[model samples]
Target: MDRRNFLRTMGTAAAVAAVSSTELGAVTLGKDKKKKAPAAETGLRVRFLGTGAADWKGPDDRGEYRRLSSVLLDNRILIDFTPTDADMLPEGCKPECIFYTHSHADHYNPEALLNLGVPTAYLGKTWISKAWKGFADASAKTGVPVPEIVPLAIGETVVCGDIAITALPANHAIDATEQALIYLIEKGPTRILYATDTGGIMGVAARIAGIDPHVKKGTPITGLIMEATMGMGDKGDEDYRLFTHSSVNTVHRTVKMLLRRERLLLKDGESVYLTHLARTLHPTQAELDANLPAPLKAAYDGLEVVF
Candidate 1:
């Protein structure tokens, strides 16, 4: 089948196979939740809808699982709409906006949004044009309304409600011609640096994180949701993958750089959670927790962090 036909088939499957609420783990807030806040008053909450790299494999017993790389913020802002994300929209949650990190199929699924009806979507200029065309084509074929595609310029901050978001440069792509983005999201006093699908946090991202206009100096970020797709693998083991995804060593080095530059100032209990894990490079979640240092943990699907 051609690529277009394959995507159409996938979209049909995704629309029919929407996951049940049971598949989504129990919703729990962070340690700070003394009494559950009213639904209308719920503050910043982030949930990892998927936490695996593109090539991640399920265990033998499961046969096949569809956990891809995506994060849902406050159940209303979605970053990346992988197939897994499309299959599992949180119960009673309708995201107002969707943010695309790049044009990678894993990060941006045009079919997933066919029926979602999300009002606004933020993506790079190139991606915006591509998405508009793709959705228009799909809509003509399937009769679904094409969503509004807005351009997200790198280094420019866009505000959605109370949240202020800036798209920073990401060093990742299928090749030199492709473009990628890493987001820095700020809500109220809490700031989160969501950097994934990138080899390392350098260039414009490093500079922006080091001195963000929205965040005050010496104030630590509420959370740093980063990717560790290569685990602890050496460059010699896999040369091609290392150029786009980060390893455990890269995570550590980036963290150190942020600290050395006073870019990340964590409070007594704040932490960094790693996502987009590769099964081949890491062991079970239990083993990972037992071995990883304090404040750095491997995140799993349904994991929630409230700030």
Candidate 2:
């Protein structure tokens, strides 16, 4: 089917499901009843800056909007710098470090990072030269000093304040020379797996599953922030598969693999959130909540979670 036809069909199904069901918010693993606590009081907090895929058009008058994907960690660390405008950032927020998944324009905006003035930024080892070029171009255009750029290797861990971050290899940008990274962040007892902008977890799942042995045995993952760019589309779609982004099928498969491998052990109250939404492929925020199972709802901008 053509893109337009596919989207129209999906939208219809989503609307139908939404009208018939009612369940919203983040998806949690297992089943239990516990009061949801504020992220500020919790050890780790994550706020999604933008939840749209690269193809996402800007917001419209009807309030259907999806910005490029990015997340703020405890308002101190930023995962990606896309759509990095003053309004997108939290008030009084200053990140100590910004982590880049790749050099994709939607994930990394040099001009935006220049304005933020973060002290340090991390990128894949293969991205240093490309990043330098971007920084140089931005500096010439904006007259902002270049921030320090650190190269990250797969499986290498870097300590940023209280958070221990490890960059894992991802299966993305196969045609490009630059590599992609998925982050594993840990603070106190809270551990979060931040995976986005990747097609599948096949190459990286084992490494992720092995992370538990490196930390305390019983320290389950406090949260999972994953990408669902393709939404509930068929995996056989050529355009979707070619882009190396996740669909509902791949996301579920990855989650199940993690659970079976004991890589991601969720405690009673932990939750899973799907971000990087593609408007054409997925339903609206409310419709998505109504359609998806518990602990697997779509994430929206300004949605904050603490674990």
Which one wins on lDDT? Answer: 2
lDDT of 2 by residue, 221-286 (tens): 657788888777464234445467887666776676566656677777455788887777777788
lDDT of 1 by residue, 1-307 (tens): 7533543444343333333322322222111112322233344788888888776655434342437788888676799876566656677776666888888877777767666766557787656667788778867876878775667667756555455677888878765555788888777666788988888875767566554333455445656888888876475136568778888778777676666666676667766888888766676787778887666788888878886
**Which portions of model 1 show Cα errors greater than 4 Å?**
1-43, 57-66, 211-220, 233-239
Q: What Cα-based lDDT does every candidate model obtain?
A: 0.69, 0.70
Best by TM-score: 2
Q: Give me candidate 1's TM-score against the actual structure.
A: 0.78
Q: Please provide TM-scores, in order, for all candidate models, with all chains considered together.
A: 0.78, 0.79
Kindly provide the TM-score of model 2 when superposed on the true structure, using C-alpha atoms: 0.79
